[model samples]
Target: MKKSTLTQDNIWMKEPEEHDFPAAQDYLELLLVPDAAKKIVEDLKKAPTIIKKSKDILRASRLPLLPETNIHVKENLKKVQKNKKLSPILLMRGQNDLIIADGYHRLCCSYYLTEDMDVPCRLV
Candidate 1:
């Protein structure tokens, strides 16, 4: 599929920055073995970007909506408010709930902006 540096909304979605994978690996390592985490990151790199609803992602992941007071959430909100491009979120399917290996803050920020927002993401 063709990948663009933009999404179909005012809240932009671009390809993940270089450091995004490492961050995903670091966070995944906390919940998995080093090799497994490494593998997932690699898979995510090859994964295609697709769109899903912000509320659906939150529901599948079962993560609570972080308050706007959260520092990271605030930062993400600031970026969006300024029309800065946001990286598409990276996701991994766990045995049960989905794992938001990275982009939790951005996801939360989008949720606050619009629960029905179409979140561009790479789900593995």
Candidate 2:
């Protein structure tokens, strides 16, 4: 399996942005099952639980990375490099798995930067 390319040594870090929430909501709506998406959106309306977790933790929590999404991940990595501040990734708890509602690419990029790197996320 190909590992993520992100590493903390090289990652261009930035704070979270305001627009990230809406973007995450939209992405989750498109990516998740309707019921799951609805729940997530409703959860987002309330205050999100902010957590700083390692890339390794996120990798273990999320679904496997698909090959088709690699290009988009790379693009996001570049965007992060250019602009350090990115919106926080959105995560949801499922019966047995953690869901990434948005910012998969950003997560991958952060993982590539360093597995142990701490990533801030808004999890519901």
User: Using Cα atoms with residue i matched to residue i, what is each candidate's TM-score against the true structure?
Assistant: 0.91, 0.64
lDDT of 2 by residue, 38-73 (tens): 677667646554646555546557666534348977
lDDT for position 104 in model 2:
76
lDDT of 1 by residue, 33-123 (tens): 9999999999999998899998999999999999999999999888876777678899999999999999999899888877877888988
Best-performing candidate as measured by TM-score: 1
C-alpha RMSD of candidate 1: 5.0
Clashes of 1: 0
User: What's the true lDDT of residue 112 in model 1?
Assistant: 80
